[model samples]
Target: MPVSPTDPVSPIDPDSTTGPDSTIGTAAAIAAATIAAAAAADDSTGTDALPYAGGNPYADYRHGEFAFTALTDLADRRLGGAVLAANDELFAERENLLLPEPAEFRPHTFGNKGQIMDGWETRRRRGAGTARPHPTAEDHDWALIRLGVPGIVHGVVVDTAHFRGNYPRQIAVEATELPGTPGPEELLAADWEPLVPRSPVRGHAANGFAVASRRRVTHLRLSQYPDGGIARLRVHGEARPDPAWLAALGTFDLAALEYGGAVEDASDRFFSPPANMIMPGRSRSMGDGWENRRRRDEGHDWVRLRLAGRGVVRAVEIDTGYYVGNAAGWAALYGRDEHGAPDDWFELVPRTRLQPDAVHRLLLPGARPVTHVRLDVFPDGGIARLRLHGSLLDD
Candidate 1:
């Protein structure tokens, strides 16, 4: 049987609310529990080991502890590669590659509405509903996908459906990354080879793109021009597991909360569909309290709330909407307790700020628990939403 990405074999133990007094011990315990569970479920596989339940296998499958059944199941779902929309220079984004909705790509039915664009003009060729061998210059379509398990992204897959005439002269996989970022903005990791060109394009059947090197890549691109039919595309890849902070970040009724001194549903007002509950905004006042400085662009306009009751918080997730300058510095997001005292002395958490039109998931580890969160704008910018999840108790 194949494993569906939506389901989890076992429910996470939510009852254990460990806090500062016992966090170290609790972390150790979780690690131990995970290892023990993996060991019992592991099956000997020459290539790599599967995780206990095998939904998201470990990076090195060889040492994984799940069963062979799990291993095979994971491979099947992850077998096909993603289809990419490429550029003339064979570059995905930097070289004239773009998406319809770059910041809100969710990858599901509702998420697929966005389109990819390559700066090329082609005559639309008609199709007879039969699968062709390659794409032509007229048809314009491509996709990007990650490979391997959801968390352990190893590569990408690109399939050029039916291009100009169902045939293309060649197809290449290009990697991209942010400028001046330690690793290649487009390349997955260091030592990545230039785009791989495919000869004899096949319709429907996909082309696999292995990662240049192992890196937790945040972007990807593809370049393809058809020699002949119309082209449709499909991209497949890893699904990132819920960020670590989510485990500790408990849920709060954000829709019923107030923001910027106005009663509103954060989700609908800020985030796109599905993740609507996560909202971001700026405020001079927090629930009718004394007003803080009200600067329209005072950085950190977004905020996330959680109900921790009496426990202490240890982590948070800040979703910076695209503009890296919006999150220019580390002091944008802050926290406070019931008495309005700054939690943890308002220490700043370092982050790789998000770029314009890109979502940057910022993780704040070792954060202290507080009843309220504050977005302190240094050079306030477009902060659409924020999410804080985790427990507030000593392990």
Candidate 2:
């Protein structure tokens, strides 16, 4: 799904903790377990294969394991993903699942429950028994997660980081579409379809799973077979939003993920994901933006995106809000009707000097229908938001 065939994998960005608000600062998580479940991972899927012998298995999933994992994280809290409810989080709070950073392990960090962990953890379960009855195979601990941008999950990463000994032996993932706001009770009862069937997991490893379901998912039910810890859960997919809702707003950010726009490919994703550039609402802080490492050599860094649909462009907003010292030096936007030769793209906004931590609204040269766009940032820096303001074209 490259806008350009030259879309080689860029350097993996250093681990970053970039969720920007209480609503998202620390939300949902995706996890993978030990090598024991390595067989379960579909090696046929590029996103499930690790290109390098890793230092951190969890790190592989983002750039190495599954290429699709690099797509927009549908359950990212920054995009409004939430860990709505968990049958149990008695050990580690469920919110830690989506911290937007690596799960750190601290020695002897004790809470009232015992040792504190950075990912979701649940207490051991005991079935109804006269003695110390073991938890039946049917017993499982579960958590409900609301997708930030509803879409079809292409792949999932289950990281059991720091959950070595206490990680669940098996896990399963199920999803369903609930367009409107749903309460915990209602969501729990909603019809659900399996995304990943019950599978073994190894502790302290990033376990990757390939999902084949084509249904648009709004929420996920993650189950830990018979109760155990799970560090994080990531659902990577393309956003599939309702066009009718977008039409109701009339003029809107045609590039908004909730409206179906997507980060097609990027040169980098560091400090934060490039996908954040089109997320809804104003960026709350520097961490709410997309950033890349400083370029030591030549050409500028760029991020290409798929527009919600064919739309006429009028103006654009490049926000560097809160990126005082690290804002891009200059930026530009280009448009394309479909993926083709490099020259198929035309300029939307010429390269213009950017003010640090400021919002710049620049009008396009003229109106034209564009189905894709590419944003180029001079040298290397972070951008809080990239708003493509325009109206959609009729089918």
Give the number of the best model, judged by TM-score: 2
Q: Which candidate ranks first by lDDT, i.e. highest?
A: 2
RMSD of each: 17.9, 8.5
Where in model 2 is the C-alpha error above 4 Å?
Answer: 1-9, 12-64, 268-272, 284-287, 339-343
TM-score of every prediction relative to native = 0.27, 0.80
Error of 1 at 187 (Å): 11
Report the poorest 10 consecutive residues by lDDT, candidate 1: 259-268
Report every candidate's CA lDDT.
0.31, 0.74
| Predicted candidate 2 versus true structure: per-residue lDDT over 192-276, tens digit per residue | 9999999877666667776767789899999998888877777777788777887887778889887888776666764567877
Any runs in candidate 1 off by more than 4 Å, and if so which? 1-153, 162-169, 176-200, 204-212, 216-221, 225-386, 389-395
lDDT, model 2, position 349: 85
In candidate 1, what are the lDDT values of residues 334-394, reduced to their tens digit? 4555444534435435333444434445555664656544444333334434445444443
TM-score of 2: 0.80
